[model samples]
Target: MASPESRIIELASRIAANTKKLNDYLVANNLPTPSFDVKGPKANLVPKQEIEVQAARAAIIDDTQELRRLVLGPREYLMSYTHNELISQQAITRFGIAHSFPVGSEASFAEIATKTGLPETNVRQVIRHAINKDIFVEPRPGVVAHNAVSRLLAEDKVIHDWVGASTDDLWQSASQTCNALTKYPGSQEPNETGFALANNTKATVYEVFSQFPERARRFGNAMRSFTEGTGFELSHVVDNFPWGDLPQDGVVVDIGGSQGFVCFALAAQFPSLSFIVQDLEPVIRAAEKQPQAIELGTDRIKFMTHDFLTEQLVHGADVYFFRWILHNWSDKYCVRILRNLIPALKQGAKIVINDNVLPKPGVMSKWQEDRLRSMDLTMTELQNSHERELEDWAELFKLADPRFEFQGGELPKSANLWVLVAEWKGE
Candidate 1:
């Protein structure tokens, strides 16, 4: 086995080579080099579907994370990191610091303080801390300006909402998570969450949001930002699945499908496939009003109020699809949801799920794995639920019913979500 120092050297070489490859790809494609300048690339310019670009990006992420781990060593890394960075981020978002500075324009600390209603001294300290994190930049001494990251927070409402929701809602819940855990050890109830504790309410996160319209809107927009992200695009689902193989005018029931976004994408590609987007009454009403859904023709794609927790209402659909839904519920609840569909499923009917599948220990890149692990914890915090491993998912099907064949899962290239399918084998 190679020494730790030798391993570090190898990782560094890999990082350098991959960085060069990514840079060369960008340059060849006439894209701007990665920079924090306000005028830098508006978005990730590299198409995720490009195989070479994806490989280079993955290499950079894996090697850089490994190199950092090796350099920091185990003990120093574990002990040196602090939640102070999260606090700094919370302060920045809470105070509207990003919104205080105009894009491409610089502002003094005093000016920012006046705009944000924070003390000038506090603004300087907090913003200086944020500057170190590459959120904002102090271009000249005492003058702060929008970097590319900060500019997005100012200009993009969805991204701004994401930051706001993360700092204000998620951070508070995370702070109280330990207390909740201590109070109700091994609890599976959603109302037993830190979110409930933080808000001084026994309601689940969703129930609490239902009472606060503004908070709910911001949370929705925040989720929209995730779906609009590079790998989370609905096009990935449209392209990867063998939807074309289905018979003409086949029915696809989208359980818990919000706003029929995925259905719209599917309708555009597979014109012959019809859809039933089912959700709660409020969600169904809103989904019906979506211009994209209307434009795609309601005749072909219809919205219906149907709760998945109860019995599945629409029977014999070619596919019963669940996108980013099951992870919000505990295994017990997920099994219930699956069992509810049995009465409705025809023999050979498909159940398609698009959601995260946790990697086995030490298998994924540290950078990517950190995100998945965080999501797992987030599920616990919000709903006493979790992201599942592949085995866990297969077991879920088996637990639901023996007749349900766990056809397994596929992680589509350039997509963050896994596509898992099962078929109803029947008695």
Candidate 2:
């Protein structure tokens, strides 16, 4: 019998096959091949509906990553693990380095330094570090030019906001997480988190950002960018849920719904369903003034200002929905928020949650799984909160009230978050 192929060779073969498949699809459709160059496509070229193509792409990603680690071997791979991966990107975002020069124009280190108010050597160091990450390019000695990534940073305000908020706020908080744990071991209070320690404030992350309007706006804008991502699109929630099964006049109360994006998406999909979007006074006031993504028919959707941490004010709504809200709070707070709805709920009332659900280890590609798990830790760093397993989610409702019947959850196909449901049995 022939000897079995080595793992490296197997990976290489798989990568080659997938690359050819993706390339053929792109070429057949006259789409531009993937590139890091200045003129690469802004959005992912592969349509989400192209399931086989997406699988091929994912296979390539997983194989290449595994092959890379295999090539590096164990000790070298361990040594290659980086802690300051975001430092260069953070410096670039903080200094507005990408905006210092216009896209399609090359600038020398000194020119960039002058524009950014940094020393020439400092500019060179930052840009050179970023270049290695494909954010920019040095075509020739001392000449810096835009790549697709850096150009996107220049052109997209929301993308810039993501990098800025990520590096400045999230990164700083993550660095202090160990210290927070050391100081307040096993604390579940949001204000006792690394965010508070890093910012030197007793307030939660939300409260800290609320104190700085521009900072809050930037953080909000960053979250907005996430909704535009393939995994977090509001369409995922609208398309896969059982909203059509409700009564013709079924009501949905969006707890802590910021700007009503989820409601807007759902309303467009299920016209018969009415929505009440509840948030803080400032958020509701701002959302009320702004035009919605979809036109709301008369009385189809209402905006109300109410903190979710307090009692739920909407009585007898069919579905009390939370999209990406509960993960920010500890179990104690989450249970409190759930119990707050008890007074308003009727028999067979549903509580719908749209949030990240931690998966079984090794069930997904390491590349993908690592990102999700990092987010779980990110919750800890920022708010002393966390992503939940399916059981953990069920446990919350049980802890809140025995009448809450956990109806279980299912992650939508190709979507990063899961939609979970519980029905309230009347007392």
TM-score of each: 0.92, 0.93
Model 2, 358-405: lDDT tens digits are 989989867778888999999999999999999999999999999999
Question: lDDT of each structure?
Answer: 0.87, 0.89
How big is the positional error of residue 412 in model 1, measured in Å on the Cα after superposition? 2.1
Report model 1's TM-score to 2 decimal places: 0.92
- lDDT per residue for candidate 1 within 1-427, as digits (tens), equals 9887789888888888888988999899888988878888767777867888767887788887767777888998787687775666777778888888678888999999899999999999888888888888887999998888888888888888888899889888888889999998988888998888889889999889999999999999997787777789787688777999988889999999978888988988988999999999998987798888877777789999998889998988899999999999988899999999999989989999999999997786666788899999999888888899999999999999999998887998778999999999994
lDDT of 1 at 406: 89
Off by over 4 Å in 2: 1-5, 268-272, 291-298
Clash pairs (backbone) in predicted model 2: none
Best-performing candidate as measured by TM-score: 2
